[model samples]
Target: MKFCYKNGILDWRIVVLVFLLYLLHALTVKILVVASIIAICESGILLFLALKRRLDLYLYTLVIILATTFEFPMFVDESLKFVPSIIMLPLISGYFFLLLSLWPLPKMLGNGSIWKTISKKFPFLFSFVSITLVLGIVMGVLSLFTDSTSKTFHFSFFVKDLMILGVFNVYALYFMYSSLIYPQFKQKLELIIFSVLVAMILAALFVSLVGAKGFYGTNEIMLMPLSFFFSTTIVFFLFYKKYSNNHFVLLIFLSCITFFMQFAYSNALGGKSWLVFFLILMTCLIFWYKRAKLKLILGSIVVFLLFPFLLNIVEKKTDGDSLSSSKLVQALSLVSVVDVDWYTNLPLSPKIRIEELLNTNLEFVKHPSFALFGKGFGGGHQDYRYAYGGYNPAAFSLEEYNNEYFIRMHESVNTIFLKFGLLGLVLSGTLLFRHCLVCNKSPWLVLGCLWFVFFWGYSSSLMSIGLSSLFIGIEDVRDK
Candidate 1:
């Protein structure tokens, strides 16, 4: 199913791809159905590719999983709307279909190899899991001490909640372990990486331009989708460092254009968006240098060219031209601070984050026991967020959810801290550390970890980071 190859240039296929995309736009009758159709059909294609033992299936699956994470057509604004959002419990996104598609995946794709890879290190992983198991039980008991803000509670369904903790809450272990076990396939995975990047960008652009309006129903286009896709796009751009200067330049150029287009859609994107782009830029400069200076310059050129277009679109789409000042949008965003000392006229959302994070950290100091094992899984910080809340557009936290004690943390680091404390932190930190350490060695693993930073607080992050430590003692096996 891969349209791009490792060797020769890809001009003709790109042209054909553009033509096909144009045709898709011409034929699109409904926008919401577009996501649904893409979800189902893409899975079918993946299933077919997996059964056929196609080499690029994993990367393509990775792209789709990411795509649906932020804006699957089925999205509805509600608390726990997506459900466990891990493997179960509540939220089901691209993972559900991806799990189904990959079950029949060929062993040549390393389906059986994972166990083989883990067999030698089973004892090590078992120890970690055993420790976590004890911790989990302790935490489960602790969960009993706290309340769920329910009226008449029934079964804790301890088993179910534990499963939720594993499958849904911290899902990243799925990829972290898999990639740790078998980081690379014996295929042109490198080219497939580029293909996946190109495909996702094109898809995102189409969605951004065409929107979620069709004869069937309409969905508002949002900034988060672009934020997720494009930030990863920049990471992928950095991943292209091994390739030619020409390729690197092209990726950054496209990434910049993607960012401008995203801004054109909505200028109200919060400060985190700015921080994310900064991280992307800084990551490139510190980790993958030399060409980064050039690429950033090129990106600025693209941004400059598209500046007027962005403003015009924003003026047309939004109610007033009086949004955030151009200078503010151009400069760094005033990110939320956890410190109570930090004070200024800011939005309620960041204030909520500051309150929640500050209070969550305080919980450990306030309750000496919590720092050891954490509030346990499913535990969270409660706040009267609504009392301070106002109309913060597109703020997920501001929504009337779960008695103001948002179960999910704004970031994975914080989430793990609230739930598992030092033990959980060590477990998660090890994974994050591994991926960050292997950022240069294992592009795939690094890719997963990087996104978890941007997409903290989902069970999906669990896929990338979990209790598994089977391969930690192996000493970064990919490069060596």
Candidate 2:
């Protein structure tokens, strides 16, 4: 296919079309579903084009979008609650598209120093998927031998978890293979990155102006893309160098946009504003690390101290008191550990989450098998409130409940332990270490990765598809 562009830049026309479709989804239900269908079709067509043209980055882009954004509601209740927005279609389609992308992997793997490095590191990469598959099989067999309806036996959970893991593994392989297959791949990769970032920023602003309506939930339409804008801007500024030029000017403008959006979101966060607050602070830390100015660090400390006051003002102005005046204070306070089971439906506080981590640690240490194999995939968490005969009317909605309902953990390492056991943790840690080691050549990328690691200790943002891509994309490009 022949393409035309002004000054050799990618055509912005496609971006405009996607943005219009995004707007139409918010305006009406029928249009929203239709637009989703069209978007999926576009991905399928793009996957084919990518395969034929050997453009693996485009293929990776489509897979990332499917995993991250394309959530089709298989079932939702009458009150618009209980949206089981499983990506079944994306899973099925992404599988085929991934297979197509991998058609040339064998040949690529047979050549190149990059390929050799990947081949040597392949076991660590494969270990995660292998452990997951083994756990699934063990759980399935246990379910068969024992009662299938046992609380620990979740067939749907096993299948869904495996499917997601499979897709992730496919993308990892493609990342490695494509880095070798394509020359000057970073330039091509960044073009797609900037294009996606610009489109998301424009669409987010449009949605915010239109009272935040979207085919997706209002909160999601506003939050997801804007969060990406906030995050990708940090990654870009940290890595890219063009001092006192248009690039730096543009960065300042975009930073202001993201700040206001996050500021507005600080109100009524169900006591979860600290996570967002920390991530933004980390972004600034990235900037300071890039230049290493003590003055900047001291200024950031003052701002951190004053941020609670700012949040309090925003909450007062919005007339929302869901978050306490002492929210930041409460976040820092520690409490004694409780003796609750790992799967209880306890009311969440910073204390409770910490206590649960303690409980998980105690249990895992007591029973070495639990530390080694875990309770098996999906056995780590349960609908504890329902299991304990408590109910909340808003349980079905995403934002209305506590963190435990969402299967969120205060620490990714703990979550990994419960889900994949010690072996998986070791493997994933090694892989991240490998990525970070390669990033010595790109100190800014190392800073970004470090920021993510810090965020993971407080929240599971690192597990999100967008952040995962950022974490992977930053280091995937070796120094040329």
Candidate 3:
């Protein structure tokens, strides 16, 4: 059967007929019910394709498996939101596939040719400063013309969009410059060292003199530098040559250690669990690191041992009570669903949640008519809230859902799905899959792709202003 398909001896009509039968049933049945049948079929197809040397089809099959895994868990309980997982898994998978399809096979995958092509057309340094200055001026003028509180001009929204666009452009330019102009290992090394030093100094200053009041109370300008620094460091270390290997490993390790120490001290002194999450992620990455053998094993072991302790520390720090201890006991007691009425009573984080709702609602409203074709270039509303939070004003409310796990909730996932629909989902998924495919052959590109994938979920609209800047920056770097 596989041989017949590979050789084109089997009639294509037969395959189409089979697919139609399955798809018809899929649409008619409950999604989970249909998905189970499709999953089995897809698995068989994947196995067949793998044996037949149909690499592309095999990969697509792998994507289907991954997508299904992510989606299926959500369907087990309607109350347990699964839409986000379903939407994201396929979207990312399709993206990776699309990216792979665009590139020349295997060897040329991460050669930086794509970046070079764009950079050759536009000079990096001139483009960077010029774009930044223009955006900054436009934003400044717009800010002056409209009242921040006024609904008419929506100055806050416009300014936010401009800022997002500016940041995206800046990131793109930086990556381009780094890849193309910073040719030597020494240049990359120097840049990383400088960035880390600057970030450390700023962090120390913020921690010591500025204090929490100053840190959170300000207009977030100080925070911007730190965020930029950390994000850049993440990008740089992921792609940089000298520090890309064992040095990067050491840096991550030390960083995790530092975070753990901070968590410990915070528990003793009263701090936050947000930092603990960051630390856990860092620790997890150490094990996920592809190169170092011993570090991965050791890191895994350490994480396992420290897991309970870390939970206790986090719980204590977060609620300022024995809540963590009780939760631990409940978890150990195999209490599957622990009811907490306090959740329903608690108010939502208005600032963040409201913005998120607005962005999602906007996308949902715009989606029906504009389903096939996306809002063409700068056609999207330039609301600051949407730019930052991916919220749609049309769909959600300021009223808190009270679920701390809203990140994985259906509401959150459905927002993007509503924006893009099936077509958008496929396109986005293809792009991500393609990225993975290309990067698989090119280690450097793999690192870059990983960085992008990791953050894609945390932000709104993967293909918007941010990606534009990122792609352009990467292109610039590759060309020089």
Clash number for each model: 25, 0, 41
lDDT of each: 0.45, 0.45, 0.35
Residue runs of model 2 more than 4 Å from their true location after superposition = 1-36, 46-117, 121-153, 214-239, 242-246, 265-297, 307-367, 381-411, 433-477
Write down the worst ten-residue block by lDDT for model 3. Answer: 217-226
Question: For residues 1-480, what per-residue lDDT tens digits would candidate 1 score against the true structure?
Answer: 444443432333543453353335323322335534544554556566656654345433543343333332222232313322113212344345435433523442456655455434433333334455456567756765664544212123334335444443222223333444343522333333344345545555565566532210123333233223433334444464344444666566667766775455432232445555656655655543455577776665576556556544644564433333322333321322332543554434455556666767766676667787876555655553333354332333432252444455556667667767788777766656655665555444444464455444343322322111112213334445
Per-residue lDDT tens digits for candidate 2, residues 1-480, read 232342332336545644664454333322345544655565567656655766564654453343224232311112332211123233353345435545655765466666457665455554554465566457534533432243333454444444454344545566555555665454444444444444555665666776743222212324232124233343345344431233455556655665555444322221343454465576567678788977888888887676556644654564524233334333423111232532232234454455445655664665565577655544444333232123333222232133332233445565556655777577668857766666534433443354344333221112233333433445444343
True-structure RMSD for candidate 1: 8.1
- Predicted structure with the largest TM-score when compared to the true one: 2
TM-score of predicted structure 3:
0.38
Clashes of 2: 0
- Global local distance difference test of model 2: 0.45
Superposition TM-score, candidate 1 onto the true structure: 0.61
**Against the hidden reference, what TM-scores do the models get?**
0.61, 0.66, 0.38
